[model samples]
Target: MASVSSSRSSPIGKLPVDVFDSILSILNEEDRDTLKNCSSVTKQWHDRCVRIIFSSLDINNKNTNAFPAFQTWLSINVDAAAVVKTLRIWKLPVEIDVDQLASVLAPLAGLQNLTLQFIREPQSQIKSSSPLSIQGPRSRSLNTLELLLPSEANRSMLAALTVICLFDTINTVGMQGFSSLKPDLRSTEGLTKVHQLRLQYLPQACASEEMNMFSGIMTSAHLRSLYLECHSPSSWDGLRILSQTFVNLKFVDLDLVQLKNCVKDVDWTTLWKALSSCAQLQRLRINPPSLVDALVTAPSKLFQTSLTSGGCWEVLRELVIGPGYSPRAESLPNRIQRMLWDLPGIVRHDLRGPFPNLDTVTVEVPLSAPMQKRDENGRSNGLAAPTVVSSEQVKSAIVRALPSLQEEGLLRITVIGRT
Candidate 1:
């Protein structure tokens, strides 16, 4: 392989053919051959393959006692832990001591991301942050934290907050599919990353707790990029608070899919007011069917007064909107219309500075999901699939809806498929 010295090019693609072949062997599940061949290829390939393979560690002690495997084998300055950047703990044994787990994780000095996924674990809230407050050889700061606590896990919202406060400095945090949290207003200083905070698909149960948690976030001098899914009135008020303190937000993903059922509760006037504070905003994404309707049907006056001529998202360069699916739930379009009737003429006229500095406008077509088929037992797939919507058709519709975007050559269209 004469390609060894070609480091100036793409770091991964520049690998020699033999090295790629070893990687292909692994992808093809020739695991025995892969371990043998990859290690034997070259010292460089050996280290690279090991790093790529173990860069993300998943621990589950319930089935195979995976924690011990890490302690006895991978943690060896065989230095596998040195390459681990993402750590996921699945169903950490309820009886296991946190101190023991902390010691095991001490060797992952390069770890930057942590995910706590509770699967098959008994319902018990973590009592304190001590379990996650590691005094070890690992890096002191984590860049991201994600909690995937589905209903099956009997999710304890308190446990979620406990894990978050452990890191002295964490930049990004995501909590998905949670039901409710017992109210706790105590603040922690760790989440000071002017980067991102995402809370999606949460039920409208704990409005007070939601306000407490998110309002505290609003007070953070370090809070930057935020994506919140709010269905209740109080939570939207939290958005009003965000407007007052959103000093450094650069990117915002506003997914209004959950608004399908609770659109009435939202004060569009308040939402527009909140968006007016993103003085540093560079990207704004208006996502999905119901959200499109919400935007289109909002009173024209809300847009007129909320943003000033001198301020409000003037620096925004990117705008993403739509999937021409009918805004009304009952009429799902099987084929794309000649015009994206759903989008109407809002973005070109209403949204930010009329987006004077807008550079790129992306329009996403609804995913082309094949119609679901029933099995011989009369059971169907989980998704009630829809007819495939062509990207070309969607693009054409978008051009009709916003002719200026096409004329100015700022329009781009996308259709994500079932991967």
Candidate 2:
């Protein structure tokens, strides 16, 4: 038995440190929990495996039972905190003192990314001098920060959190579900240096003060990439600010959605004007909201006229439209055919200027159609999901439009389905 066991022994644990290191390095984030168990097998494995395991921490207040233990671990294994490069806090726990949490994270000087997602209405107004305002040592290394706020979240809290230890080194900022933040945040030292800004879920009918505050934030930052997604067509108050500011802007993505009743010609014209004013923009993506109508009388002429009148997209290299849904009076196949035949003509007329840097124009079509499937007997097939159009026809439509495009390799089509 002893001889057999000796012959069957594994050499994985005894491998050279570099070999073991390479193996751990290749492991994906999902394998970290498994690697954590391996960390206990031997001292050599523990050092490397533990470091990798603690590199990213996801702390959610919903997991109430496990949080205290996590906090205690951070307190005891102070060195482990140093390895954490990414920290995500889903919701702050009311029971735990923010200062204590800050203390636990104080040693995380190497932290590079932080995400704070808080939507819960505060139990009480958080004072400017609240313990949560206490700065931690590692806040200086945090460069990329994502702030997710619920509509009801206090703007003061958003400003206070932004001003925390995180204010010093943050350069890239992503905000979701916040129509506007405190105007005072524009004066914060960190926001002025931001280069990439992404804002999503902007509320409809923004107040003048709120628009000013949001505009101030955008204008103050020397943004290179600005991505905005709005809940309604009328919510894009920041477009005016971008046209005048963000002189260094390179990439812009506007995902604008409108209610069935809100689609108007002025909206499209406003959008085109905004695009024209961005003289330095390189890549542009416009995902128009789904307009539920029997026929969205192909605004091809309007698009051509507006784009031609507005100045040329001087450095624009790539343009993408849709993953859009437009319900027409005709059948799915007919509508697809019309869009394919019409889009190229629109592009030919609209884009007559010197597109020296223009390269690709992408039409993104959604696989799911707005119509119901029909059976052979012309009855609604309730068992099957709705089919708008087939993927092949969509691709063919893009292929047909290619010849009309200014550049040969310029036309591309992308089809995205419900995730």
Best by TM-score: 2
User: Which digits, one per residue and each the tens of the lDDT, describe model 2 over residues 253-290?
Assistant: 87754434455533555666766777788998776555
Q: Number of clashing residue pairs in every model?
A: 1, 3
lDDT by residue (160-265, candidate 1, tens digit) is: 6545544556778887755455444564334434257887755655445554565553344666778876545555666666666665788887765555545556
RMSD of 1: 9.7
Q: Which pairs clash (backbone N, Cα, C closer than 3 Å) in model 2? A: 294-328, 294-329, 369-388
Residue 284 in model 2: lDDT: 82
TM-score of 2: 0.72
| Sliding window of 10 residues with minimal summed lDDT for model 1 | 1-10
Model 1, residue 264: displacement in angstroms? 3.7
Assess every candidate by TM-score.
Answer: 0.67, 0.72
Residue 237's lDDT within candidate 1 is: 68
Report the error of model 1 at residue 405, Å. 4.4
